[model samples]
Target: MDLGVKVDNLPAEAMMELAPRVEAAGLDEFWLIEDLGLAGGFTQVAAALERTRRVRVGLGIAPAAVRNVAYLAMEVATLARLHPGRFLMGVGHGMPEWLSQVGAHPASLMAALEEVTVALRRLLDGEQVAFHGSHVHLDRVRLAHPPAVPPPVSLGVRGPKGLDLARRIANGTILAEGSALDYIGDIASAAKGLDHRLTVFTWLSVDSDGDTARARLRDTIAEALVHPAMSVQLRSWYKADLTDAAIDALAVAGTPQDCAAALRRLADAGADAVILQPVRGAESAQIASLAEDIRPLLDAG
Candidate 1:
């Protein structure tokens, strides 16, 4: 399995700086999130790709409801042509409340996400697409300059139905942070007969002392456990009370050996790539440890 990191919750300017650091650290991929008001995923991806030569850059997700499929395909094609195999695209249904606030929520979230993903992939593959689904409509649209090597398109979603949709249409699936081993294993089991790739995001914090590293993630884990979407998935996967002890299964935290073990467990559960999302205040240090410390342990293991 490959290892990667996400530029989560960091200031927009950090992308330029972090991109090089991720590459220099010998990580395989660097990912960017497209939150409601954050830096645009496509723009950040373009900038990061321009700044780095080797590391693959991914848009962990761009909401399907907001962007028009044809135009989105153009943006994707432009980046793919420039970066080729170095770009990975992920699209999904936006958060319900956030989408509603922006008036971009579709009546049928599943249909909208499915339609957008299908159309986008077809366009990127240099095929003329005429798709008319619940939320996406295109009239024989095609990209004039499709990349010779089309980038993989993953779907960022959680839930059985959404996972099924991803397996049917996308090249891979992106699981959100707080995805536990059981959840990943179940998803992997379901995809056992296929070639679907799994990219998992998990909160990360590291210290020489295992307890200290886990302590740093206490508040963050608590906050994540309360999220509507994450809570449902986590609660279903974990029967025990949600506490610091649960951190080992839910996140990559603790000493280098502990973090390495946690990551290896995720990889064993069938994650193709585990993307570390650092704790808010300790982004740089956590990443440095991931490269200088945890990575070597994983390699040796």
Candidate 2:
């Protein structure tokens, strides 16, 4: 299993510092989040790639609804050509509210996502795309300079239909933060026959005291409970209460040993890569612990 750390929507400058740290620590991948108002995904990815030599850089998702498919393909192709096998791209349906706020929500999010992903992949593969779907319309569009080796494109989506679409068109599936073991297993099972990568993002917090570490995630867990995608994963364990066990199921928290065990469970449940997302104030320390403490335990086990 590949281990990675997410630079979650942090300031752009954070990459200059964090990317090298991740590579020095021997992490396999460095991921970035591209929320609506945050730093641009492509920009951060370029900066991270520029700063690091080994660690693979990924944009956990660029909202397909807002970007034209051809333009998105160009940006991805440029990065792939420059970095070769070191870039991973994720495209998805943007958050409904966020898309609406920006006046970019499509009439059919699923159609838009599918169309964009298909066209984007085709363009990356150096195909001349002439597509006329419900949402995406292109007439003989192709990249001027396609990558010799195309980058992997994953779909960041939650619903069943979206997952099915990912299976059909994407190289991988990106499960968001708060993904539980059962959910991961289910996704893995569904992709049984295909050569698919299941990349899971889970919350991470670590300290000498396991209780203190777990406690730090309470507020974030409470907030996650309300999101539709997160709630699906938590609902099986959630019954009128949020208990310690439930928290353990959702996050890789606690002491080094505890965090290692949590990550192991995720891997055993079929996670190709488990991306650790640190709680807000504890980013640097958690990354260090993940590298120095948790990872060694996992390696030994």
Candidate 3:
């Protein structure tokens, strides 16, 4: 039932401004994402963690294909040591086009992810790793300075195979934006019997004026639907319904009461944490409403 806000596409300067606001507003977590050619996740996370004293900072994911396992482990360990109990580290398969554009996409995603997660975890746990997998090759690698406590590692993945791998190997799972309630339930069922954190990002907009909230939310969903992951996944699950603008069901928007109710449903469906992602330029206002209006309800319930 942790409440978080996703800082998607926010610039570094804005993050510096927003991180404190998020903390001051009483939000529990501030999550960020690293896309191809955008700001680096580790640097942004460092800035956010430095700026905030209480709220936890997280990378929704940094692509595994683009980083060496040893280097990734080092970066994570450094942050964990510097900011104990306050960083959630997520890594997984990035977009295929982006990965291929950079010539980093693996031939077999399953093999690459499995190898990376295992090696990365071992390295973070201060174990000497000598891995020689198809995608990752480590030669008796061990961190010079490992954190006494390892940071939580989550995979940003979807589909049955990917979820299975995350459940088996990683510490947690991250469901991407626009995942339906039924879909979340399916993932929850999959996540049972394991001590995994199920973090989900849903399109979010909340205002006292319900119309304004829904309109802004619709715009966000419109953009989200065009993303390759959302498009393919929604079409596969909803099929003909996707053609009818079914994005509303995938999003949560309205007045504070409405938004809180939607979040309650997600919590009931087994979301360990829900990160509210606003449409472009709507982040600050949404964060305020989440902190002031919506969060209290979730807290009370």
Residue-pair clash count for candidate 2: 0
**What tens digits encode model 1's per-residue C-alpha lDDT throughout 184-276?**
999998889888899999988899998988888887777776677675458653445556678887899888998999988998999999999
Model 2 lDDT per residue over 1-301, tens place:
9999997667789756888989988899999989988999999999999999999999999999999999999999999999999999998899989999999999999999999999999999999999999889999998889999999999998768988999999999999877768888999999998989999988888999988988898888877766655667665754325667867889998899988889889989999998888878677777888889998998999
Worst 10 residues of 1 by lDDT: 235-244
**What's the ranking of the predictions by lDDT, best on top?**
2, 1, 3
lDDT of each structure?
Answer: 0.88, 0.89, 0.84
- In candidate 2, residue 227 scores what lDDT? 60
Residue-wise C-alpha lDDT for candidate 3, range 1-301, written one tens digit per residue: 8888887676789877899999998988989889987788999999999999999999989888889999999999999999999999998878888999999989887788888988999999999999998999989889999999999999988787888899999999999887878888888898798899999988887878877778776655666666666653454444333332354467678888888889888889899998878767877877887888988887887
Error of 3 at 228 (Å): 5.9
Candidate 3, residue 47: how far the Cα is off, in Å: 0.5
Residue 156 error, candidate 3, Å:
0.4
- In Å, residue 29's CA in model 2 sits off its true spot by 0.6
- State the displacement of the C-alpha of residue 296, model 2, in Å, after optimal TM-score superposition: 0.8
Model 3: lDDT of residue 35: 90
